[model samples]
Target: MPPAQNTAGPGREVLTSDDIDRALRRIAHEILEANKGPEHLVLLGIPTRGAHLARRLADALERVEGTEVPVGSLDVTMYRDDLRSQPTRAVEPTVVPPGGVDDKVVVLVDDVLYSGRTVRAALDALSDLGRPRAVRLAVLVDRGHRELPVRADYVGKNLPTSTAERVMVRLAEHDGEGTEGVRIAGPAEVAP
Candidate 1:
């Protein structure tokens, strides 16, 4: 798929930076509370947008819990089947640490939770990395309609969208220069 753009259509802003900050703060509290601490928790973001979200979440978690969290990014472009439907060019590179994921609590972060295909691909990509003791997921927006049984452990927001609508997530890390958050566009306005 082409990189998601920063634009507006209908409906209000489902998630703004303020919204994202609040969500991250809350999720950080939840993660610390559930995991007992930030120790042994390795955060891996599904590349492109997910990696960016993961970094933000890691910082929040670190600030809230006073622990250093290792954050990494994984690119699952090769694992995706819709290369033809993607942009004219392929996606960015996938990078993982040499240490591997042995017996670590992996929290996968992503921007928009759509059909769960990306999460599925991430799982496949992760298998080659190594064995993590357990895997968890954190999505900025959960837009329902999952093609896979995948679910996020920490969700910032839950949005109900139609098949005709498009959900776009913009992160300052990716969009850069002062743009961020998530928005949805009408079917006709987006490339089908």
Candidate 2:
């Protein structure tokens, strides 16, 4: 997939920075509560924006529980089923934290949950790492159109959208030099 752009004159903003902050905070709290504190919890964010979100969540969790949570990045490029159809792309570094994922609660973070294909690829990539006690998913936006039997354990927003529409999440950490927000672009406006 192509990189998400911060261009103008296309999608209308659906979420503001404050909204994203609130969502992250809520998600962080939910994660902490669900795990009964951050003990043995490892967060792995799927690149490129997921990694940024993961770091943010880790920071929030640290402030709440007064304990540092391990955060890592998992790149699912090679693991994607559409890789054969799409052009070859660079494989990003898969950074596992100091302690491996063995017997820990692994939460996969991502910007948006659409077709569930990315999450599927992420699961495949994760299997090579180590077995976790449990695996959960957390997404900033859940635009329901699942192709697989996957669901997010924690979601920031449940956006109902047509398959033709595109959900774009912009994070300052990733999009660089822009206001962070979520936008939905129509098929005609989005570049091919």
lDDT of 1 by residue, 35-115 (tens): 889877888888778888888888999898778888889888888767669846456766665466788888998888889
**Steric clashes per prediction:** 0, 0
lDDT of 2 at 10: 66
Q: Using alpha carbons, what is the TM-score of model 2?
A: 0.93
- Distance from true location, Cα of 163 in model 1, Å: 1.2
lDDT of each: 0.82, 0.92
Which prediction has the highest TM-score against the true structure?
2
**In candidate 2, which residue ranges exceed 4 Å CA deviation?**
1-9
**Candidate 2 at 152: error in angstroms?**
0.1
Model 2, 1-192: lDDT tens per residue?
A: 999785543688888889988899999999999989999999999999999999999998998889999999999999999998885677889999989999999999999999999999999999999999999999999999999999999999999999999998888887775658998998997877
